[model samples]
Target chain A: MTARDQVPDGAATVWQRAVRARERADREEQLADKHEAIATETRTELHFRMAYIHRTTAARHRVTADLLEAHAVRTAEWTRRGGPPPLFMTGVAEACDTASVAVTLIDADSNQLAAAASDEPARHAQDLEYALGEGPARDAVAALVPVAASGTALRARWPGYGPAIESLGIGRVVAVPLQVPGDCVGALAVFDPRSATTDITRFVWVADALTRSFILGRDAGDGLLGEIDHRPEVHQAAGMVSVQMGCHVSDALELVKARAFADSRTVGEVARDIVAGLLKLG
Target chain B: MTLQEQELAAVFAQLTGEAARDPLDTQALLAALVESSRRLFGARGAIVQYTPGGAAAIQTDGTDGALQALAADAVGWREGPGHDARTTGCALIDVDVATHPTQVRWPRWSPRVLALGHGRVTALPLFSKDGPAGSLVLFTAPGSLLDERALKLSRSLADIAGHTLSLQREVSESRVLAGQLEHALSSRVVVEQAKGILAARHELTLEAAFARLRRYARSRQRKVADVAREVIEGRIELPTD
Candidate 1:
């Protein structure tokens, strides 16, 4: 397919916008440095502080711009390769030196409300966690730290989850919690990473970059929110189950997870069935 | 607490809060500094003279025509307790304006202090990190020296003002940087979109299309982003060279 046919106008526009932003940010940052040098020469706190602020703001812009450039490059390359549809999470996967990774955003109760994965296997891995309600992403969020488990250790820590995930031929996994001041938003999960040394710091960096430059940045305006796998169907299924079983929404969600786990089906699949009136629970 | 004391507490709280935040609003903070110091010490009025900019902002508790004239005179004459303190990096107190040594030192402006019906004037240096950035002057009734407590409090307020001013400058500079980034990013997006359009239409590679876009932009002496916007909107076309 041609580049335009392969890449949607909106997607192209987003990446291009990001590139221009980065360029401008770089210029502004240099200007700030010049001012800072002058302030340093005079040794005035007020002038130095002003210059410092400008530099910091410019740095923020630079970061956003860098992210957009990466995104645009990834999109163009994917279009050229005639690959499967592009997802922003693909960038995180590439950054982590892995082909399979997922970025998941959790709600207040630590439920995965939105997710974007690099590939189907990665998506399935995350879906399994959401269905089982026990996984690296959930644990990382709960502990507010990075969690890495490979092979047998993964199964030992999460008896059901470890065995289920192993069935997917994933030998190792690592997750890092994404955090902002006073809030742990979610976690980034890397599965079967190509890099042998499980550098938890690398995972942390990806999470930080995503949280600051993409999720919280201006690029994540109204349009990008839709890109997140919001999984409204799951919430709808939970609502239906709640009404039928006379349980709280939370309990209904648990039931949905349990049914998915029992059937060895993805929570999304089970949720979809319930939403489609093909499944019942009491 | 008494009304005046309560007001002073609120003002200090606001100033302290602003200083702690990322962006310090210098103008608003300075105004508050004068207002709080004027009320706390019961001064007729207060004036802040910025060191670097030589700008003076005045805040008065009530209609004090004398204080206004005195502030104007200090700025115009470039001499007085405020100017002296800023220069010396030390506080200046003229308790008795009539026969004070300041009259001799500031022959032109010192006598005017007495004429303004000011019993006492105190100038506190607004010390920045390196040195005095400006001066905060308080005008009080004649024969009424700021008590030890009031003197200490006013000095602390001046210190706060200096810090706040620095922070405010930082915040404004950062905001300008953010605006620049947003503008650049939006422009870039337009350029990238145009490249995609070119690549798709001509069956050319993305790189080739971008190079063409750049080539066209350079030839026309225009921004690549502006050219890209034209291409995307079909307002212009690149030469097939």
Candidate 2:
């Protein structure tokens, strides 16, 4: 058959075919664009969060803070995380609820913490893992693999309490680890009663953003939320400065921050040099 | 609750509920106000003039098309070069048959509005934190009944409409301005990055980096983007930095 004749013989009527073809094209283009975006955003979210910590201060904090606030409002699922998590988790839970999905981070040691539970029953169910000392979320953290359990089946696995969950009408559960740098601090879990969890791209984005943020905060160790500073890279760059100048990390930081201050710039500006291997510490 | 009171309360509650949704569509709301107020208040015809800081009123022969024509004529007045926010608020030219123009308190808006309509009219100022956002100027057919309930409802509608307009305006304007800010910051980031690279590559100061970029652009006859793209791409690195 000619190339035109090779078209499907009776896939659908002409009108149907056109509609289907248009739909398929739209779907493909949307999928492709979204696919590229998720990939770009996945990488950029980490970089951006790292950049943020190196940069965040009173003046520059407005946009990111507004964004974090909006994200909490946007996430509609986190209300159930029980009396709210720690302050950070409130925002995180807000984000999870907005997306109607799970978000989690585990610290260096495999401990269940820093979780914002959007679906309350899931939090209660998750506590089964913490209280009784067994659950897939913890396992996923240790294995660094996401865990999914169907509501129908999870009840059977937890036998004594699984039936209670079924009674509460909870449907599905999913947990993704907030992994970044050397530490995997916690995992976020989400559940829904009527729908199985999908559209996890948002939660994944949150996890990536917070993971890098958590590490940077931990490393700053200066009684500040470091990793989100966007200047930690400056600090890391300072580490490179210490190595190049044979000085202490603290001295290197002081020098960089001093230069930034002298010029009314941020520490990240000066630290970029040491990290890029282009400038030696003065 | 009594039946009549319950009905009134329910209506109030619904109006309050609808008022809460964000990004309240102002254009859709303007059209809705014209239709519903005309029907609810039994005006011969109504045109609720809406603007950024004020509004006007007009009378029609009990048809939307007549109202539409009157509104169109009013819009035509807006295009002339001299018209301003003040003139928009008080004018009364084509709104009714040549009635005595009342340029009393808000002279800017009052005189023009009287020329347009022939009726007993009231224009209430609508203000948000900023100054007046709009007004609720309704025309009653000469000698029509002005019941207290109807007056309160009309005033309430004006407050609700003005608040909604303010909110929508705030959201959209903020979104646009924020987008602009984000774009500027992103560009600043490029400038900042170029500054960083220049600072590192040439062991020169950041101000020095900027001067080098400016000097190179002046000498070579290239756009700033060409230079920035070069710095960012690592091709035409500013050695002067």
Candidate 3:
């Protein structure tokens, strides 16, 4: 079969998005050049700042295009091989020189609204953070800065989460806040990354790219390439618990998390039981 | 830098610095633009007719009240060099208001403009990526024309203002889109939570709970998310059975 015919429909669509992103990046670059020309001619600081803004925007679009293209190629290969579907975060993790990465979208209060992970360990690590109510991702988002912990410091920083994630064989972690102009929307967490990969600047660029192009820009309608997991079951369980115990939904959410931690199970497992009417909590 | 270059630099800095302070205040930016144009070009008056994304605004600056008033009214009449330049996306260079062709072209506008003590009009188009954004009109004394150098300076000023306004519009649009996305996500979460609450309270399936929630919201002419929030908060309990 021809390469075009061999590619899956989803991969084809992703490839098309990649092409569009590249075109937009080129346009942004041209705009930056025009602004730079004006700045040079007029010798004004304002035009120079405008040029910088356009250059930064162009860089973000370029990164997004690269990521989308990588995802499309991986997906096409996976379709041919037929095992598990390729994840969008896998390319992100590779960019950071790690095997595991997780992106967590948060509400204004720094509560995680959704999450996507590159692999099972990263997924488990995210769940541990949700159940324990603390982790690098949460800290990075709350403080609006990068958070890093390794070895003993990990356990020292997060008594509950560090020990739990360490048990899953992850020793080092780093996370950066994904910020827009006036808001911090999410965090990107790297698990068991190499020491060389701890360059915070690289992580920041990836976080910004994900926030601008994937989460909140024109491509946001695709829901981060359909990789984001909003964990509806957890919220639903919180609702059921709230009605059963005559408490607020937020309080019920905490109760559900507490139950999951106490039972040594993932939040998703406990939430599924609660939603299925097989479990109840006060 | 030459004296002229230094003055040009200061004007650009001032225009952009003020805009940076309050990017959303398009009126303030337009007013500053016209005032700067009037002073820089040594015109009797300057008028800017800006319509960015359908929100039209007319700003005028001059020592003569009659000429400024006429400039504002000319936008409504669609009869000045500003209107022509805006519609055609081309600059009008030193058109004598008393000329026969100018009078015949704008019969009502040319005579009133002449009576206001202005004899020459020059208009530069403000262009954006989308198309013609607006035009900048400069009125001068009889027999006084803007030289080639002044016309070039006017075009640059108008171009920069147009680019800034376009950037402002893009930022505003993105902000709106981001807000809507956040709202939609939060609303969906609330709706899901409300479904679970109703399901447990009435021993109904989640689907049935959602149906009841929608029914109550539609009946009251309210948003489902609002009704759902109330349900989750225990403020408004839907009827059972």
Whose TM-score is greatest here? Answer: 3
- Per-candidate fnat, comma-separated: 0.00, 0.00, 0.53
Kindly indicate the candidate among 1 and 2 with the higher TM-score: 1
Q: Tens digit of lDDT per residue, candidate 1, span A64-158?
A: 56556666776677667866656666666777788899878776667565777888889899988888788999999999999999978988999
The lDDT values for all models are: 0.68, 0.45, 0.81
Q: Tens digit of lDDT per residue, candidate 3, span A115-155?
A: 88999999999999989899999999888999998899999
> Between candidates 1 and 3, which one is better according to TM-score?
3
Instruction: For each candidate, give the interface RMSD after superposing the true interface residues on Cα.
Output: 16.5, 17.3, 2.5
Cα error, residue B202 of model 3, in Å, equals 2.2
Cα DockQ of the candidate 2 complex: 0.01
Per the 3 Å backbone cut-off, how many clashing residue pairs does candidate 3 have? 0
Provide the lowest-lDDT 10-residue window in model 3 chain A.
A1-10
